[model samples]
Target: MNSDPDRQVPFLSYGFRPFFLFAGLYAVLAIAAWTGWLALHDMPGVWITPTFAGPPQQWHAHEMIFGFGMAVVSGFMLTAVPSWTGARRIAGTPLLLLALLWLAGRAAIWFSAFLPPIVVAIADLAHLPVLAVMVLGGLMVRPAPRNLVFFVFLALLTVANVMIHAEWWDFTSDTASPALDAAVLLLALMVAIIGGRVVPAFTRNVLVMRGPSTALPRSFAWLDRVSLASLAILAGLAAAQIEGPPTALVAGVAAAGHLGRLSFWRGMATGGAPILWSLHLAYLFLGLGLAALALAHATGMLAVSAALHLLAIGAIGGMTLAMMTRAALGHTGRPLRVVRPIAGAYALVALAALVRALGVDLLPGHYMAVIYVAGILWVAGFGIFSAVYAPILVGPPLPKNPPSA
Candidate 1:
């Protein structure tokens, strides 16, 4: 096997190279389309007609979670697994084929009306399992015990996706919401697992690189295990749609466990660096969102959708953007620094989370307006990231040795 990857064409040489760009582009276009549909679909002379299977709301949520979120995950895993397990990375033909699978899923969902429901579901559902095979198979070669839990989450996610499609195909009744809820919680668990590792490490790296003698984060074994177990239990209960005092109790306990887990991470020291701070903030949103979810189950004072948005836009969206930016720069051999526009991009996404999660609840009279504003902010933030990173993603990787060197 050739050790040197063909870098003449950068996009196909590495997993993160193309998938990050595609995920960012899709985030912008999907949200814009969803917003247009929401604001104008019922108007007398709307120009763009949105056509798809299932209710518009479900379609939007499905695309955001299963479509955009999965793309980011695929990119990250493809690149990160090599580092974790010392296995050969997926590149060249294999990488391109995986990307095509993802693209095909997106297109099948968009034009689902023209195809049979089962066909559409099959097309959209094939990517994740293949992704799992690639990741777990690679890990099997090296056998990392700690990272093995990701396979369990991936399995649960695939089951949720199947339930979602089952509801759409009329094989089941009202399964989509609980399935989506389950999927969201599973992703949050991944965020917890990944974020717990990366956040403290990144913070420690920055401080050490800058010659600071700060006390780094300490990991608590009991808290870590408890948090993961609680989240897994929550995902199962959510999928079963078991609500009432028991559900509320589990949610509350899970929330507290996660909060305790985060407190051990040195989030306060990450303030000066946007790249590091964004991740801490995103993880913070996860804890807060889970707490709000507990409140929703207990008192019914807040809409479940609000809590969902907090996890969706805040945790998933924020963390993906932060990771993409950092990974793109690091893989390209550039300095670990955030540009001004990218910093602004991070802020815009955070603002989107705030407005979507809280603004709609506080100002009921202007619900649509709030959504439109949040959509615009979300789109613009991702659009900015796409534009800024396109050159790096498509062009040759940054030269290892500059002419000056």
Candidate 2:
């Protein structure tokens, strides 16, 4: 552990420690409480009395993307962008303030049903889009060629968020779904973009493992560019769903492009490391989510609602879970060994995603049962991560320069 708090207090220095710590803690408590809200709705002492008026479906949709998913995005962006641009880390007072913004937003959303709807509109929708501004603002001032596009992503996310808020405010129902889709796709794109860069880099650094050698795939940077173009075209079509065959075409291509991007990352040799496998598997959800949607849309029989949870629970939720776990451990200066509980935690989350996806369809009568188990598993997964990592944050960090993976 660094004896000097001053040193670690710098944003990049503490890296994923603080955000990951708080995020994991919040994940367990927040999602569990939310799950409880779904089943046992009359608990008064619960977090601010569930107020957002909807069936559990839409509420869960909003919270998981806006709630659990947003927190992970905050942690990763605050921690990583500074390092990417050689800018000073957003730590001490500013970092803490940003975290408060997140917490306040959560509070506002929790009591949203009770409060006026507009209040929920301003508070819940405001944070991350603003976060996009803050993060990109730093990066834009002193640009890194490799990273500037991410800033575009951060900004586009804000636009999607505004559309989401607009939908909630009774502007239109169609906008919300597309906005939600864009946000998840953007996150997956970020994961694919960033993960492609970091995962193998981290793996090689840790295990001294070489990249897989099966006539290794092309970088396909052009595909990334085209994917963004496809998303933009789809987003426009989404704006007017009734007007365009091009909309369907774009979505189909975008989904396939993401799958190809995943393939190029050379996704093996990850099985040996917990951090590595978790990331690789989470990314697989990205491809799966997109493909599922593409196929769902192509077949007239498929519903849009059925395709979304694939990205929500599986891609977005899983990617966040894997990243928070790995980033927490790595940035904390801890060794890369997995404890048994943590291993079980990983397994539980994967199971949760599967149960939510497959179980819901196959056993309509038992959907709640699947969800209940998923909620339990999700809570347990983060609970374990938080417990193990809490001491690492509140106290001095673990010793620097620990052994490799």
Indicate which candidate wins on lDDT: 1
- C-alpha lDDT values of all predictions: 0.86, 0.67
**Candidate 1 positional error at 12, Å:** 0.9
lDDT of residue 48 for candidate 2? 42
Q: Give TM-scores for every candidate, taking all chains together and pairing residue i with residue i.
A: 0.95, 0.83
**Number of the predicted model whose TM-score against the real structure is largest:** 1
Give candidate 1's error at residue 231 in angstroms: 1.5
lDDT of 2 by residue, 262-344 (tens): 67655675566777677767767766766666666676444455556666666666677777766666666667776777767
Worst 10 residues of 1 by lDDT: 1-10
Once model 2 is optimally superposed onto the true structure by TM-score, how far is the C-alpha of residue 216 displaced, in angstroms? 6.4
How displaced is residue 335 in candidate 2, in Å?
A: 2.3
